[model samples]
Target: MKISELSRRTGVPVASIKYFLRQELLPAGRATAATLAEYGDEHVQRLRLIKALTALGGLSIAATRNVLAAIDQADSSEGALGAVSYALPVPVAAQSAAGDEEEAEADATAGAEVAELLAALDWQAPGTSPHVQGLTSALKELRRLDARYAPGELAAYARLAESVARLDLERAAGVDDPVALAERAVIVFAICAPVFELLRRLAQEDQVRRRAAGDGAEAASPR
Candidate 1:
């Protein structure tokens, strides 16, 4: 697609898109004979992802860039978050149920999700135990506040929590005793996901109200 179309689709202006390109937040669309090139689905996906992260995710451009860079770096690495994986027990029954008929319904999908996330991110699995627990606490609070979120969303959140926990374990890999090691993924998740989620839902609510207001104006105005 052309820059104009990309702009229309993302609801971002062509000028802003160019800015991102200049900032390297986005990859160069294409090199053209005339001096500029065309864009494709990858650019489109990235633009949308950027919008969700910035507009909804509330991350600054620099932070978003860092996160994206991390994911890309992790994707290129071997696994288990590099040296951190050794801290984890090579991935275990940490998954609640794996091979049962009852379990095949993607019951423990969070592990896979977080694993994929780690592969994509260049983030470190911080070993902050209190931070991990705080995240878990926030999720519990979220479920209490809003019941509309699907189970899958909750599971995805859980996977992240687990990943953080594993990350804590990774940081402790140098310690020989699994019998006593501190963990902190839940705390990190608390600090990260919930407040962002609150923003996304509030944005959704405001968008709905704006549409309703516009409809009311339409109904009330001279036609």
Candidate 2:
């Protein structure tokens, strides 16, 4: 396919496609002549991956380029199929439920919002996983309770999630086997979430109780 079709099919502009090629983000296609070349389905897939990285992965072009190169290089290697260079999962969202307009749009939009916010904040909190989606649902509940609230207000919770991410990475560092490390990381890390939330809630309740007791004692004292 020509560059024009590549742009049409990918929904990305032709100039942006050329810019990606020039930046070496996409590999050079077969050189048909001095000024033109043919792009194949592989090129289409690569371009899609590039856009996905930007749109879903929340990576800047420079970061996307580096990640693409790393991925491409890894693909060329004879390493075991399960081996990965980084701890991050591939940037991808799941297929949404069909035949439900509101449900689908809400999920898709929230996924995009979550991706951008997470990438911008450099948070790695399972952007498309069940946990993040549940978090998003919780956020919607928050919004319904107070329509004035915005999603940005909720991301402050990242301080805790990131604290967990740090702890998770440290725990994984002690394990050498990739499978065992991943298994423990996901399983144990997920269990920590509810416990951590409970601790925070309990601490807040204790503070509230203390303040209430102080107020009652003051009220009971002679004026």
Candidate 3:
């Protein structure tokens, strides 16, 4: 297929496809003539993967390139997952916590709390992990907001997060192709994070309504 056909098939613009080629995000096709190239099904698959990383996964060009390289180099499922997760941009709060001198104490406290939470759950991850660091930042913010969210208060949330993560990993584990698995992980995390937040808010509203209705029913009943 020509570049135009590739664009048509993938719903990507021809110019954008050319740009991907220039950026080395997409590999060059076989040369058919001095000014022509022929793409194959592999190219189609590659384009779709690139689209998923950038569009669905919301990765920048540089990040997408790194992930692509990781996918190509990965020999196993864990390697692919590591590459995908590492290539994701760190949360802004976590980045700020890492650099801000004012956050040092809070970061340390949050780190200790997180360590305790991890030990309680028998989970292992480096303190420097982006996910761990992100959690530290969030815990720090929560502590700043209220004394109610003290060091040990995150255990319940952490347990729920672990349950969700286990389900995600189980689905990924069934995938045989490392590249496909990486793509699935990236897309699922990127899309589902916001979806999860929205669902939480919806559940909160439902709980409030249910409690309000129960109170109304009790008030209307005879003593």
Candidate 4:
């Protein structure tokens, strides 16, 4: 098909498609003449993946490029999974007071707490993981607010996270195509994250209502 046909079929504008081709986000179509080229089904699929990453998954072009490279170079399922994992954005930790000794000490303490928590949970994430940084930052904030999770509570949260991760990996393993699997990983998380949060909020509301009406199992049980 011609570029125009590719653009029409994909619902991507001609200018944008041209830009993608120039950026090498979309591969160049087969040159047919000085000013014309022919695209195929693979181009359509690639364009859809690019749109999903940029438009729906909210990845920047650079990140999208890295993810695409990962897909292209991946030799195994684990390699593809690792590529997507590393390409995903990490949450940046908030900065503290500049050159303040006490603030530095507090930050160090939070880092220690994060390490301890991860150790207790038996998670083997790298020290450089954004999740570790984010958790350390959150722990610092909790200390500032004089609020902290009990060890048992933190452990429970870790267990739940592990279960969710296991389910995600299982689903990813089912896909035969590495590129499609990588795309699915990003799209599934983007779409399901909000839905998961909403379900948690709804469950909280239901619990509150049940307690207020003295109808919950815990509310009805002997105190």
Root-mean-square deviation per candidate: 19.4, 17.6, 4.3, 2.9
Clashing pairs in 3: none
In Å, residue 182's CA in model 2 sits off its true spot by: 4.2
Q: Provide the global lDDT of candidate 3 against the true structure.
A: 0.81
Model 1 Cα lDDT, one tens digit per residue, 1-223: 7889999887989998998898787899777758668998778767765665456545677766764554344533333133222322121222333357644444333334444444455445443433333333343334334533463675565576567556544644553321111112222232334655687699678667867888655444554
Q: Over the stretch 120-197, how does candidate 3's per-residue lDDT look in tens digits?
A: 889978987888888787778777765436445567777788888887788687887876787788776777777878
Off-target runs (Cα >4 Å) in candidate 4 are: 91-99, 216-223
Off by over 4 Å in 1: 76-126, 133-223
The estimated TM-scores of all candidates read 0.40, 0.42, 0.86, 0.87
Best by TM-score: 4
| Residue-wise C-alpha lDDT for candidate 2, range 1-223, written one tens digit per residue | 8888888998989899999989988888889999898899877767776776565544578766665555545533212112222323432343334457766666666566667767877865565355566656544444334542465664666666677767756755665533343334433443444577798899778667767888656444555
Give residue 53's lDDT in candidate 4 (0 to 100). Answer: 80
Model 2: runs farther than 4 Å from truth? 1-105, 124-128, 145-152, 214-223
Determine which window of 10 residues in candidate 1 has minimal summed lDDT: 177-186
